[model samples]
Target: MSNDSPKLTPRQQEIFELIQQAIATTGAPPTRAEIANQLGFRSANAAEEHLQALARKGVIELVGGTSRGIRLKAGTLRGLHETRRAPASAGKSRLGSLSGLTAGNLPLPGLEQLVLPLVGRVAAGHPILAQEHIEQSYAVEPSLFTRTPDYLLRVKGMSMRDAGILDGDLLAVARTREARNGQIVVARLGDEVTVKRFQRNAQGVTLLPENPDFEPILVGPDTPDFELEGLAVGLIRKDF
Candidate 1:
């Protein structure tokens, strides 16, 4: 290690290792919620502060305007990899304890699973996956969904029951600004977030709920409040 490298405290080291392990296993850095959950922190802000410290110490770089934009230094990553390769048994034990994951839980080289943030309610006009909105995160197998979702939004209503989506279900959503007609999407109208089938024409856009009890929402072409957050790619319901 170079003298220029910042000294990491035990907690800082653990957070740094978690970030690296996340990138190694999931192909994406962990969100604040993920780190908090893994570390048993009651609030995600603790993880946020640690990340800021890491940045200040030159251990990790934080990208502005993105939630999971953490970057590990190339030299630090190489050093971490070398540490993992040091002794066969030590490497196994270290890998086994990363955020409580063992080698068996990690995906093979070509098969990377995704760790998606579970977004709760969105504060009006704020980004959907903003730090405050993320409740937690879950890992899903790559082969289990239609497409890779950027995050999971908790379903709130029976608006799409006819389409098998229910209240309290977890909706897997892929990030995209555009949604084709007839596709289910997570959309925003002012402060409200809703799941509905999308349709558009020269006149305007119509958000159609599958349940007849709910009326379709009409947005004129020039409406400034309407925004498409993402497309619904898959669904998950917890038995508990």
Candidate 2:
């Protein structure tokens, strides 16, 4: 809104409006590919280029390696709503004056900070969860997940389709050396590693596949060689 702010080209302005509208309604911004689809651009890279330009122009801010991190420079509706609720009448008192009455006597912190490592391309037949394979780390607010994740693993297969985990989805994994029965986990069975909902009976433990097309793998008790790598906390999918 400032004259000093760099001006966007007509095409860039159109893309900016789309992003703004998306954030206003959904409380999150659109992905680069979504912008491309909206504007009928043939390549997602074109949308990414425009987004970078907007960031350079001070029109928006981008949080790398995470979905829905785009924030508009212009005030959002939530900001305007808070402004409207401020003390407007002479009789109406403000809460800031009573802050000392609270337990902490301080404003609440925004959100919990947790760094999640992004592990690319999990190989089903290998130990892909090794620490050395982490490509990047993303700082996320812990409130975003049901449980805090030790790291984020990029899902590579459609084995858990019925569990709603699709290929290319970001799986939030909580690191645990042991796992209880009937928890969805990232596990290593011998040389192979996989994500599946676990089930254990007197016979043995079964790695149940959520997708009907995929068969469940049974590991006998005699072969107690499998390692429970971690528990799945949550998932993230980029809309494009």
Candidate 3:
């Protein structure tokens, strides 16, 4: 590790670690109020102040207009992990070669990239990952996701815009057949696959959209052609 790594105060480190814990546990960042409650802060304002400091230090990026808009910057995500290990591991470069699996988890150490198959559309009655379904591949940093992704799906619509997932975003996905309530998931109903929050109750599973302009999709547990494809592990926005 270079001396260039951003330094955090003891309190800032505590708050930052809390943020990482929330993401790892719930697949989302804790709200300011959640942070305050977790750390016994008198108010969310105190949490926000520390968040602002972390943002200024480039340890995280605070997105406006969303309660869970806290995003960890890519390169620095694993830097925290770096501090915990023995000093010998410091020789590992977080920006090492781009190789992990298809991208070749390259023989290097630290935070490495995983070359994930970029899935396009799902043809009815076919496996979601059938070779023909993949449009290309993307080398994504695993540290950016709470879990390593099995693939990258290009989001095609704006139904999830309010959740900060806009059209054309690459939604990193970890293959899974089940999801917790409120967790975003990639699901296929009939011949269409959509990304939405997973909700279940007496009425069955409802794929709730982030945008009110769109209607939630209902999937009976026994609904034919219905399948849970994967969980939304992370997101990548194209710079166009």
In terms of lDDT, model 3 sits at 0.73
Candidates' C-alpha lDDT:
0.69, 0.60, 0.73
TM-score per prediction, in order, is 0.54, 0.50, 0.78
Query: Which prediction has more favorable TM-score, 1 or 3?
Result: 3
> If ranked by lDDT, best first, what sequence of candidates would result?
3, 1, 2
Error of 2 at 96 (Å): 32
Best by TM-score: 3
Residue range 128-186, candidate 2, lDDT tens digits: 55666688876654433334678877777888654445677667787787666656788
Q: Taking the tens digit of each residue's C-alpha lDDT, what string does model 1 give over 1-240?
A: 334567999899889878756544433467788899999998889999999999898757675544565666433533443455566524421221011121243332444568889998888878988999999887755443335679988889877765556678777788899977867788998888899888899888999987778999999967778889988765566545
Q: Look at candidate 1 and tell me the lDDT of residue 240.
A: 53
Q: Write the per-residue lDDT of candidate 3 for residues 1-240, one digit (tens) a residue.
A: 225668889899788777766665545577899999999999999999999999999877887776667777654645544543448665232221111112232223544768889888889999999999999887765555546789888888988765656688777788999899988899988678899889999889999997788999988867899999998777776663
Q: Give the candidate order by descending TM-score.
A: 3, 1, 2
TM-score of 1: 0.54
TM-score of 3: 0.78
